[model samples]
Target: MTTLQVEGLTKVFGRGAGRTVAVQPMDLEIDTSTALGIVGESGSGKSTLARLLVGFETPTAGAIHLDGRPISRMLSMPRERREFRRAVQFVAQDTFSAFDPRRTLRDAVATPLRVLREVTGPAADAEIRDVLGLLQLDPALLDRYPSQVSGGQRQRFALARSLVVRPQILLCDEVVSALDVSVQGAVLNMIRDYCETYRVGLGFISHGLPATTFIADTLLVMRHGAVVETGPTEQVVDRPEHPYTRTLLDAYRRGPRRVVAVDPVA
Candidate 1:
Protein backbone atom coordinates (compact mmCIF):
# COMPACT_ATOMS: atom_id res chain seq x y z
CA MET A 1 0.00 0.00 0.00
CA THR A 2 2.75 2.45 -0.81
CA THR A 3 0.71 5.38 -2.06
CA LEU A 4 3.64 7.63 -3.02
CA GLN A 5 7.28 6.80 -3.63
CA VAL A 6 10.15 9.27 -4.19
CA GLU A 7 13.47 7.90 -5.37
CA GLY A 8 16.69 9.77 -6.03
CA LEU A 9 14.77 13.03 -6.06
CA THR A 10 16.74 16.23 -6.52
CA LYS A 11 15.85 19.85 -7.24
CA VAL A 12 18.44 22.51 -7.90
CA PHE A 13 18.02 26.20 -8.61
CA GLY A 14 20.32 28.57 -10.54
CA ARG A 15 23.40 27.34 -12.36
CA GLY A 16 27.18 27.13 -12.32
CA ALA A 17 29.06 28.55 -9.30
CA GLY A 18 26.09 30.66 -8.21
CA ARG A 19 23.75 27.63 -8.24
CA THR A 20 21.76 26.69 -5.15
CA VAL A 21 20.76 23.20 -4.22
CA ALA A 22 17.15 23.15 -3.13
CA VAL A 23 16.86 19.44 -2.53
CA GLN A 24 19.60 16.90 -2.80
CA PRO A 25 18.75 13.49 -4.27
CA MET A 26 16.66 11.58 -1.73
CA ASP A 27 14.39 8.55 -1.52
CA LEU A 28 11.31 8.01 0.63
CA GLU A 29 7.94 6.31 0.67
CA ILE A 30 4.57 7.22 2.10
CA ASP A 31 2.14 4.40 2.72
CA THR A 32 -1.54 4.65 1.86
CA SER A 33 -3.93 6.25 4.36
CA THR A 34 -1.13 7.15 6.69
CA ALA A 35 0.54 10.44 7.68
CA LEU A 36 4.16 11.22 6.87
CA GLY A 37 5.98 14.26 8.28
CA ILE A 38 8.92 16.03 6.68
CA VAL A 39 10.70 17.96 9.42
CA GLY A 40 13.49 20.41 8.90
CA GLU A 41 14.81 23.87 9.65
CA SER A 42 14.16 26.82 7.35
CA GLY A 43 15.93 26.49 3.95
CA SER A 44 16.25 22.73 4.47
CA GLY A 45 14.48 21.97 1.16
CA LYS A 46 11.45 20.42 2.86
CA SER A 47 9.04 22.66 0.95
CA THR A 48 10.99 22.14 -2.28
CA LEU A 49 10.50 18.40 -2.06
CA ALA A 50 6.81 18.88 -1.26
CA ARG A 51 6.34 21.14 -4.29
CA LEU A 52 7.98 18.54 -6.51
CA LEU A 53 5.80 15.76 -5.15
CA VAL A 54 2.58 17.72 -5.59
CA GLY A 55 3.51 18.81 -9.15
CA PHE A 56 3.93 22.49 -8.29
CA GLU A 57 7.59 22.20 -9.30
CA THR A 58 9.48 19.88 -11.57
CA PRO A 59 12.45 18.01 -10.20
CA THR A 60 15.93 18.77 -11.41
CA ALA A 61 16.59 15.02 -11.52
CA GLY A 62 15.22 11.69 -10.23
CA ALA A 63 11.75 10.22 -9.96
CA ILE A 64 8.51 10.27 -7.96
CA HIS A 65 5.65 7.84 -8.35
CA LEU A 66 2.05 8.24 -7.32
CA ASP A 67 0.51 4.79 -6.98
CA GLY A 68 3.19 3.28 -9.25
CA ARG A 69 3.11 5.93 -12.01
CA PRO A 70 6.05 8.29 -12.34
CA ILE A 71 5.16 11.96 -11.88
CA SER A 72 7.14 13.07 -14.92
CA ARG A 73 5.52 10.39 -17.04
CA MET A 74 2.05 11.25 -15.77
CA LEU A 75 2.43 14.94 -16.67
CA SER A 76 2.77 14.24 -20.40
CA MET A 77 -0.94 13.70 -21.04
CA PRO A 78 -3.79 16.18 -20.78
CA ARG A 79 -6.29 13.76 -19.22
CA GLU A 80 -3.74 12.24 -16.88
CA ARG A 81 -2.54 15.71 -15.91
CA ARG A 82 -6.04 16.76 -14.95
CA GLU A 83 -6.52 13.56 -12.99
CA PHE A 84 -3.20 14.06 -11.27
CA ARG A 85 -4.14 17.60 -10.30
CA ARG A 86 -7.38 16.44 -8.74
CA ALA A 87 -5.85 13.42 -7.00
CA VAL A 88 -3.26 15.43 -5.07
CA GLN A 89 -3.86 18.77 -3.37
CA PHE A 90 -1.76 21.27 -1.45
CA VAL A 91 -2.56 23.55 1.52
CA ALA A 92 -0.52 26.70 1.31
CA GLN A 93 0.88 28.67 4.23
CA ASP A 94 -0.87 31.95 3.52
CA THR A 95 -4.58 31.28 3.51
CA PHE A 96 -5.50 34.76 2.37
CA SER A 97 -3.25 34.73 -0.67
CA ALA A 98 -4.28 31.21 -1.62
CA PHE A 99 -7.76 32.43 -2.51
CA ASP A 100 -9.04 35.19 -4.73
CA PRO A 101 -9.96 38.25 -2.72
CA ARG A 102 -13.01 38.80 -4.89
CA ARG A 103 -14.50 35.42 -4.09
CA THR A 104 -16.34 34.52 -0.92
CA LEU A 105 -15.21 31.48 1.02
CA ARG A 106 -18.15 29.51 -0.34
CA ASP A 107 -17.24 30.22 -3.93
CA ALA A 108 -13.61 29.44 -3.23
CA VAL A 109 -14.43 26.08 -1.70
CA ALA A 110 -17.11 25.26 -4.26
CA THR A 111 -14.97 26.05 -7.29
CA PRO A 112 -13.44 22.59 -7.35
CA LEU A 113 -16.73 20.76 -7.34
CA ARG A 114 -18.02 23.01 -10.08
CA VAL A 115 -14.94 22.36 -12.20
CA LEU A 116 -14.87 18.58 -11.67
CA ARG A 117 -18.65 18.22 -12.10
CA GLU A 118 -18.78 16.07 -9.00
CA VAL A 119 -21.60 18.03 -7.43
CA THR A 120 -24.75 19.79 -8.58
CA GLY A 121 -28.38 20.58 -7.72
CA PRO A 122 -29.86 22.03 -4.54
CA ALA A 123 -27.83 19.49 -2.56
CA ALA A 124 -24.69 21.45 -3.38
CA ASP A 125 -25.53 23.70 -0.47
CA ALA A 126 -25.72 20.69 1.78
CA GLU A 127 -22.38 19.48 0.44
CA ILE A 128 -20.82 22.75 1.47
CA ARG A 129 -22.41 22.52 4.89
CA ASP A 130 -21.19 18.98 5.38
CA VAL A 131 -17.62 19.86 4.46
CA LEU A 132 -17.69 22.89 6.73
CA GLY A 133 -19.11 20.75 9.49
CA LEU A 134 -16.30 18.22 9.03
CA LEU A 135 -13.88 21.04 9.71
CA GLN A 136 -15.96 22.03 12.74
CA LEU A 137 -16.90 25.26 11.00
CA ASP A 138 -20.30 26.80 11.29
CA PRO A 139 -22.38 26.42 8.15
CA ALA A 140 -23.66 29.95 8.56
CA LEU A 141 -20.18 31.33 8.05
CA LEU A 142 -19.79 29.76 4.64
CA ASP A 143 -21.18 32.89 3.00
CA ARG A 144 -18.85 35.22 4.84
CA TYR A 145 -15.74 36.68 3.25
CA PRO A 146 -12.34 35.31 4.17
CA SER A 147 -11.48 38.66 5.75
CA GLN A 148 -14.46 38.31 8.05
CA VAL A 149 -13.14 35.08 9.55
CA SER A 150 -10.47 34.49 12.14
CA GLY A 151 -7.04 33.15 11.16
CA GLY A 152 -8.00 29.70 12.37
CA GLN A 153 -11.27 29.90 10.43
CA ARG A 154 -9.49 31.04 7.29
CA GLN A 155 -7.09 28.10 7.56
CA ARG A 156 -10.00 25.77 8.19
CA PHE A 157 -11.78 27.14 5.16
CA ALA A 158 -8.65 26.59 3.08
CA LEU A 159 -8.50 23.04 4.35
CA ALA A 160 -12.19 22.57 3.60
CA ARG A 161 -11.56 23.69 0.03
CA SER A 162 -8.85 21.08 -0.43
CA LEU A 163 -10.98 18.32 1.07
CA VAL A 164 -14.05 19.36 -0.89
CA VAL A 165 -12.46 17.75 -3.93
CA ARG A 166 -11.93 14.53 -1.98
CA PRO A 167 -8.34 14.09 -3.04
CA GLN A 168 -6.40 10.86 -2.43
CA ILE A 169 -3.33 12.57 -1.01
CA LEU A 170 -3.13 15.90 0.87
CA LEU A 171 0.06 17.92 0.90
CA CYS A 172 -0.07 20.19 3.93
CA ASP A 173 2.61 22.84 4.04
CA GLU A 174 2.83 24.18 7.60
CA VAL A 175 -0.96 24.24 7.61
CA VAL A 176 -1.19 25.15 11.29
CA SER A 177 1.95 27.09 11.98
CA ALA A 178 0.23 30.46 12.01
CA LEU A 179 -2.47 29.38 14.46
CA ASP A 180 -2.47 29.39 18.23
CA VAL A 181 -1.68 26.16 20.07
CA SER A 182 -5.33 25.39 20.84
CA VAL A 183 -6.38 26.01 17.26
CA GLN A 184 -3.49 23.98 15.98
CA GLY A 185 -4.52 21.01 18.10
CA ALA A 186 -8.11 21.22 16.90
CA VAL A 187 -7.08 21.42 13.23
CA LEU A 188 -4.69 18.50 13.69
CA ASN A 189 -7.47 16.41 15.18
CA MET A 190 -9.74 17.30 12.28
CA ILE A 191 -7.10 16.29 9.75
CA ARG A 192 -6.54 12.99 11.55
CA ASP A 193 -10.25 12.36 11.67
CA TYR A 194 -10.70 13.14 8.00
CA CYS A 195 -7.88 10.80 7.02
CA GLU A 196 -9.33 8.01 9.14
CA THR A 197 -12.83 8.52 7.79
CA TYR A 198 -11.77 8.69 4.15
CA ARG A 199 -8.67 6.49 4.26
CA VAL A 200 -6.54 9.07 2.46
CA GLY A 201 -2.81 9.67 2.74
CA LEU A 202 -1.26 12.92 4.08
CA GLY A 203 2.12 14.51 3.69
CA PHE A 204 2.75 17.17 6.34
CA ILE A 205 5.66 19.53 5.80
CA SER A 206 6.80 21.69 8.69
CA HIS A 207 9.80 23.26 10.37
CA GLY A 208 8.24 22.57 13.75
CA LEU A 209 8.71 18.88 14.42
CA PRO A 210 6.73 18.79 17.66
CA ALA A 211 3.53 19.97 15.99
CA THR A 212 3.57 17.05 13.53
CA THR A 213 4.76 14.36 15.96
CA PHE A 214 1.24 13.54 17.14
CA ILE A 215 -0.18 12.93 13.68
CA ALA A 216 2.58 11.45 11.54
CA ASP A 217 3.15 7.70 11.36
CA THR A 218 6.53 8.17 9.69
CA LEU A 219 9.09 10.97 9.96
CA LEU A 220 11.60 12.24 7.43
CA VAL A 221 14.19 14.77 8.54
CA MET A 222 15.88 17.01 6.02
CA ARG A 223 18.78 19.47 6.29
CA HIS A 224 20.96 21.44 3.89
CA GLY A 225 18.68 20.35 1.05
CA ALA A 226 19.15 16.67 1.85
CA VAL A 227 17.50 14.00 3.97
CA VAL A 228 19.32 13.54 7.24
CA GLU A 229 17.23 10.84 8.86
CA THR A 230 14.01 8.93 8.45
CA GLY A 231 12.15 6.09 10.18
CA PRO A 232 9.01 5.15 12.07
CA THR A 233 7.63 8.21 13.86
CA GLU A 234 8.21 6.97 17.39
CA GLN A 235 11.61 5.52 16.57
CA VAL A 236 12.78 8.73 14.95
CA VAL A 237 11.47 10.84 17.78
CA ASP A 238 12.74 8.60 20.52
CA ARG A 239 16.06 7.71 18.90
CA PRO A 240 16.89 10.34 16.31
CA GLU A 241 20.03 9.39 14.36
CA HIS A 242 21.01 12.65 12.70
CA PRO A 243 22.42 15.90 14.05
CA TYR A 244 19.72 18.00 12.41
CA THR A 245 17.00 15.69 13.66
CA ARG A 246 18.43 15.97 17.13
CA THR A 247 18.44 19.79 16.77
CA LEU A 248 14.77 19.89 15.81
CA LEU A 249 13.82 17.53 18.64
CA ASP A 250 15.83 19.62 21.04
CA ALA A 251 14.11 22.81 19.90
CA TYR A 252 10.75 21.35 20.94
CA ARG A 253 11.97 20.03 24.27
CA ARG A 254 10.53 21.80 27.32
CA GLY A 255 13.66 21.19 29.40
CA PRO A 256 14.27 20.18 33.05
CA ARG A 257 12.34 16.90 33.30
CA ARG A 258 11.82 16.88 29.56
CA VAL A 259 9.07 14.50 28.50
CA VAL A 260 11.72 12.79 26.37
CA ALA A 261 15.42 12.51 27.07
CA VAL A 262 16.79 13.94 23.82
CA ASP A 263 20.07 15.76 23.31
CA PRO A 264 19.76 19.54 23.39
CA VAL A 265 21.83 19.95 20.24
CA ALA A 266 23.78 17.82 17.79
Candidate 2:
Protein backbone atom coordinates (compact mmCIF):
# COMPACT_ATOMS: atom_id res chain seq x y z
CA MET A 1 0.00 0.00 0.00
CA THR A 2 1.20 3.50 -0.78
CA THR A 3 1.75 5.88 2.10
CA LEU A 4 1.77 9.67 1.75
CA GLN A 5 3.44 11.61 4.55
CA VAL A 6 3.63 15.34 5.02
CA GLU A 7 5.46 17.31 7.69
CA GLY A 8 5.05 20.97 8.43
CA LEU A 9 3.07 21.42 5.25
CA THR A 10 2.14 25.06 4.80
CA LYS A 11 0.75 27.28 2.07
CA VAL A 12 0.89 31.06 2.14
CA PHE A 13 -0.19 33.37 -0.62
CA GLY A 14 1.59 36.62 -1.33
CA ARG A 15 4.21 38.35 0.78
CA GLY A 16 4.32 41.36 3.08
CA ALA A 17 1.01 43.31 3.13
CA GLY A 18 -1.07 40.99 0.97
CA ARG A 19 0.09 37.86 2.69
CA THR A 20 -2.50 35.22 3.47
CA VAL A 21 -1.96 31.81 5.00
CA ALA A 22 -4.07 29.26 3.21
CA VAL A 23 -2.90 26.19 5.15
CA GLN A 24 -1.03 26.28 8.40
CA PRO A 25 1.82 23.88 8.95
CA MET A 26 0.30 20.45 9.46
CA ASP A 27 1.62 16.92 9.76
CA LEU A 28 -0.33 13.97 8.51
CA GLU A 29 -0.07 10.69 6.69
CA ILE A 30 -2.47 8.52 4.71
CA ASP A 31 -2.36 4.98 3.46
CA THR A 32 -4.24 3.01 0.90
CA SER A 33 -7.57 1.53 2.03
CA THR A 34 -8.08 4.38 4.52
CA ALA A 35 -10.25 7.47 4.26
CA LEU A 36 -9.30 10.77 5.91
CA GLY A 37 -12.20 13.21 6.07
CA ILE A 38 -11.38 16.88 6.18
CA VAL A 39 -14.19 19.10 7.52
CA GLY A 40 -14.25 22.86 7.80
CA GLU A 41 -16.31 25.90 6.93
CA SER A 42 -15.67 28.20 3.99
CA GLY A 43 -12.12 29.55 3.77
CA SER A 44 -10.97 27.07 6.40
CA GLY A 45 -8.15 25.92 4.10
CA LYS A 46 -9.43 22.38 3.68
CA SER A 47 -9.38 22.79 -0.07
CA THR A 48 -5.96 24.35 0.09
CA LEU A 49 -4.62 21.31 1.95
CA ALA A 50 -6.07 18.98 -0.65
CA ARG A 51 -4.59 21.09 -3.46
CA LEU A 52 -1.21 21.09 -1.77
CA LEU A 53 -1.25 17.33 -1.24
CA VAL A 54 -2.14 16.74 -4.88
CA GLY A 55 0.56 19.16 -6.07
CA PHE A 56 -1.99 21.54 -7.56
CA GLU A 57 -0.66 24.14 -5.14
CA THR A 58 2.98 24.16 -4.20
CA PRO A 59 3.60 24.39 -0.49
CA THR A 60 5.11 27.63 0.75
CA ALA A 61 7.25 25.48 3.10
CA GLY A 62 7.27 21.88 4.25
CA ALA A 63 8.18 18.43 3.08
CA ILE A 64 6.13 15.69 1.46
CA HIS A 65 7.08 12.07 1.10
CA LEU A 66 5.51 9.30 -0.90
CA ASP A 67 6.52 5.80 0.08
CA GLY A 68 9.55 7.26 1.87
CA ARG A 69 10.85 9.34 -1.07
CA PRO A 70 10.69 13.12 -1.21
CA ILE A 71 7.89 14.35 -3.52
CA SER A 72 9.54 17.56 -4.60
CA ARG A 73 12.75 15.93 -5.74
CA MET A 74 10.81 13.12 -7.39
CA LEU A 75 8.55 15.57 -9.23
CA SER A 76 11.56 17.27 -10.79
CA MET A 77 12.18 14.17 -12.86
CA PRO A 78 9.82 13.43 -15.76
CA ARG A 79 9.57 9.71 -15.08
CA GLU A 80 8.83 10.11 -11.40
CA ARG A 81 6.49 13.04 -12.03
CA ARG A 82 4.26 10.99 -14.30
CA GLU A 83 4.36 8.11 -11.84
CA PHE A 84 3.52 10.42 -8.98
CA ARG A 85 0.54 11.86 -10.84
CA ARG A 86 -0.75 8.42 -11.73
CA ALA A 87 -0.63 7.46 -8.07
CA VAL A 88 -2.36 10.60 -6.70
CA GLN A 89 -5.40 12.49 -8.01
CA PHE A 90 -7.56 15.35 -6.77
CA VAL A 91 -11.28 15.48 -7.50
CA ALA A 92 -12.12 19.13 -7.10
CA GLN A 93 -15.33 20.62 -5.67
CA ASP A 94 -16.47 22.20 -8.93
CA THR A 95 -17.09 19.15 -11.06
CA PHE A 96 -18.95 21.19 -13.69
CA SER A 97 -16.20 23.63 -14.62
CA ALA A 98 -13.50 21.03 -13.97
CA PHE A 99 -13.92 19.83 -17.53
CA ASP A 100 -13.44 21.50 -20.89
CA PRO A 101 -16.77 22.12 -22.60
CA ARG A 102 -14.98 21.99 -25.92
CA ARG A 103 -14.06 18.33 -25.63
CA THR A 104 -16.25 15.28 -25.66
CA LEU A 105 -16.36 13.19 -22.48
CA ARG A 106 -14.60 10.37 -24.32
CA ASP A 107 -11.64 12.64 -25.12
CA ALA A 108 -11.51 13.87 -21.58
CA VAL A 109 -11.24 10.39 -20.08
CA ALA A 110 -8.92 9.20 -22.81
CA THR A 111 -6.49 12.06 -22.20
CA PRO A 112 -5.33 10.67 -18.87
CA LEU A 113 -5.02 7.09 -20.03
CA ARG A 114 -3.03 8.29 -23.03
CA VAL A 115 -0.75 10.58 -21.07
CA LEU A 116 -0.20 8.96 -17.68
CA ARG A 117 -0.65 5.30 -18.56
CA GLU A 118 0.43 5.55 -22.20
CA VAL A 119 -2.59 3.65 -23.43
CA THR A 120 -3.70 4.81 -26.89
CA GLY A 121 -6.20 4.36 -29.72
CA PRO A 122 -8.45 1.35 -29.19
CA ALA A 123 -6.93 0.62 -25.82
CA ALA A 124 -7.85 4.07 -24.50
CA ASP A 125 -11.39 3.60 -25.76
CA ALA A 126 -11.55 0.22 -24.06
CA GLU A 127 -10.38 1.60 -20.74
CA ILE A 128 -12.73 4.58 -20.91
CA ARG A 129 -15.74 2.40 -21.67
CA ASP A 130 -14.72 -0.01 -18.93
CA VAL A 131 -14.52 2.73 -16.31
CA LEU A 132 -17.85 4.14 -17.44
CA GLY A 133 -19.32 0.68 -17.05
CA LEU A 134 -17.71 0.38 -13.63
CA LEU A 135 -19.36 3.61 -12.55
CA GLN A 136 -22.62 2.42 -14.18
CA LEU A 137 -22.65 5.46 -16.47
CA ASP A 138 -24.07 5.08 -19.94
CA PRO A 139 -21.41 4.76 -22.63
CA ALA A 140 -23.43 7.06 -24.91
CA LEU A 141 -22.71 9.98 -22.60
CA LEU A 142 -19.10 9.81 -23.63
CA ASP A 143 -19.96 11.39 -26.95
CA ARG A 144 -21.49 14.47 -25.38
CA TYR A 145 -19.73 17.59 -24.16
CA PRO A 146 -19.59 18.48 -20.48
CA SER A 147 -22.44 21.01 -20.78
CA GLN A 148 -24.72 18.48 -22.39
CA VAL A 149 -25.12 16.43 -19.23
CA SER A 150 -26.64 17.01 -15.81
CA GLY A 151 -24.51 18.01 -12.82
CA GLY A 152 -24.71 14.51 -11.44
CA GLN A 153 -23.66 13.05 -14.76
CA ARG A 154 -20.69 15.40 -15.01
CA GLN A 155 -19.66 14.49 -11.49
CA ARG A 156 -19.80 10.80 -12.29
CA PHE A 157 -17.95 11.36 -15.53
CA ALA A 158 -15.26 13.25 -13.67
CA LEU A 159 -15.04 10.40 -11.22
CA ALA A 160 -14.76 7.91 -14.05
CA ARG A 161 -11.92 9.89 -15.56
CA SER A 162 -10.02 9.77 -12.28
CA LEU A 163 -10.68 6.08 -11.77
CA VAL A 164 -9.49 5.27 -15.27
CA VAL A 165 -5.99 6.04 -14.09
CA ARG A 166 -6.23 3.54 -11.21
CA PRO A 167 -4.83 6.00 -8.73
CA GLN A 168 -3.61 4.75 -5.36
CA ILE A 169 -4.53 7.94 -3.49
CA LEU A 170 -7.66 9.96 -4.28
CA LEU A 171 -8.12 13.43 -2.84
CA CYS A 172 -11.71 14.58 -3.33
CA ASP A 173 -12.68 18.16 -2.51
CA GLU A 174 -16.40 18.69 -1.69
CA VAL A 175 -17.58 16.27 -4.35
CA VAL A 176 -21.17 15.92 -3.09
CA SER A 177 -22.02 19.38 -1.77
CA ALA A 178 -24.10 20.36 -4.81
CA LEU A 179 -25.92 17.17 -5.76
CA ASP A 180 -29.26 16.27 -4.24
CA VAL A 181 -29.41 13.61 -1.56
CA SER A 182 -30.24 10.85 -4.05
CA VAL A 183 -27.46 11.74 -6.45
CA GLN A 184 -25.14 12.28 -3.55
CA GLY A 185 -25.83 8.79 -2.32
CA ALA A 186 -25.03 7.25 -5.68
CA VAL A 187 -21.78 9.19 -6.12
CA LEU A 188 -20.70 8.49 -2.58
CA ASN A 189 -21.35 4.77 -2.91
CA MET A 190 -19.44 4.59 -6.16
CA ILE A 191 -16.45 6.34 -4.58
CA ARG A 192 -16.42 4.18 -1.46
CA ASP A 193 -16.74 0.99 -3.44
CA TYR A 194 -13.97 1.89 -5.81
CA CYS A 195 -11.63 2.85 -3.03
CA GLU A 196 -12.39 -0.30 -1.12
CA THR A 197 -12.18 -2.58 -4.10
CA TYR A 198 -8.91 -1.07 -5.24
CA ARG A 199 -7.41 -0.43 -1.80
CA VAL A 200 -7.10 3.27 -2.62
CA GLY A 201 -6.46 5.90 0.02
CA LEU A 202 -9.02 8.73 0.19
CA GLY A 203 -8.86 12.35 1.27
CA PHE A 204 -12.40 13.69 1.45
CA ILE A 205 -12.61 17.44 1.91
CA SER A 206 -16.00 18.97 2.59
CA HIS A 207 -17.94 21.49 4.67
CA GLY A 208 -20.88 19.11 5.13
CA LEU A 209 -20.19 16.83 8.07
CA PRO A 210 -22.53 14.01 7.10
CA ALA A 211 -21.25 13.82 3.55
CA THR A 212 -17.63 13.83 4.70
CA THR A 213 -18.13 11.42 7.58
CA PHE A 214 -20.18 9.17 5.33
CA ILE A 215 -17.08 8.39 3.31
CA ALA A 216 -14.29 8.98 5.80
CA ASP A 217 -13.39 6.83 8.78
CA THR A 218 -11.04 9.44 10.27
CA LEU A 219 -11.99 13.05 10.83
CA LEU A 220 -9.85 16.16 10.58
CA VAL A 221 -11.61 19.35 11.59
CA MET A 222 -10.09 22.67 10.61
CA ARG A 223 -10.64 26.33 11.35
CA HIS A 224 -8.64 29.39 10.40
CA GLY A 225 -6.23 27.22 8.37
CA ALA A 226 -5.22 25.01 11.30
CA VAL A 227 -6.41 21.69 12.59
CA VAL A 228 -8.80 21.80 15.53
CA GLU A 229 -9.45 18.12 16.17
CA THR A 230 -8.81 14.75 14.56
CA GLY A 231 -9.45 11.09 15.39
CA PRO A 232 -11.73 8.19 14.58
CA THR A 233 -14.99 9.34 12.98
CA GLU A 234 -17.16 7.92 15.75
CA GLN A 235 -15.11 9.50 18.54
CA VAL A 236 -14.97 12.87 16.90
CA VAL A 237 -18.64 12.71 15.96
CA ASP A 238 -19.92 11.47 19.33
CA ARG A 239 -17.27 12.84 21.70
CA PRO A 240 -15.61 15.79 20.04
CA GLU A 241 -12.63 17.01 22.04
CA HIS A 242 -12.41 20.54 20.74
CA PRO A 243 -15.20 23.09 21.16
CA TYR A 244 -15.11 23.85 17.44
CA THR A 245 -15.66 20.21 16.62
CA ARG A 246 -18.58 20.08 19.02
CA THR A 247 -20.01 23.12 17.32
CA LEU A 248 -19.76 21.37 13.96
CA LEU A 249 -21.44 18.26 15.33
CA ASP A 250 -24.19 20.32 17.01
CA ALA A 251 -24.86 22.20 13.78
CA TYR A 252 -24.94 18.96 11.84
CA ARG A 253 -27.50 17.34 14.14
CA ARG A 254 -29.79 20.36 13.94
CA GLY A 255 -30.05 19.88 10.17
CA PRO A 256 -31.65 17.01 8.29
CA ARG A 257 -29.39 14.02 9.01
CA ARG A 258 -30.00 12.27 5.70
CA VAL A 259 -28.01 9.50 7.40
CA VAL A 260 -29.57 7.14 4.92
CA ALA A 261 -27.94 8.91 2.02
CA VAL A 262 -24.60 7.11 2.33
CA ASP A 263 -23.52 4.93 5.21
CA PRO A 264 -19.75 4.93 5.96
CA VAL A 265 -19.31 1.45 7.35
CA ALA A 266 -19.96 -1.14 4.69
lDDT of 2 by residue, 57-136 (tens): 78999988999988887788999999999999878869767899899998898898889999998878888888887677
TM per candidate: 0.91, 0.95
lDDT of each: 0.81, 0.87
Q: Give the per-residue lDDT of model 1 (tens digit) for 1-266.
A: 44778889999899999899999989887655679988888899988888899888899899999888997877888777767777888898889899887888888888887675468666777787888877878877778888898998999889988888888888899998898777877788888779878888889998877667877888988889988888889899889888777877887776321212211110
Residue 85, model 1, lDDT: 70
- Which run of 10 residues does model 1 get worst, by summed lDDT? 257-266
Off by over 4 Å in 2: 259-266
Q: Residue 96 CA error for candidate 2 (Å)? A: 3.2
**Considering every candidate listed, which one attains the maximal TM-score?**
2
Mind sharing the TM-score for model 1?
Answer: 0.91
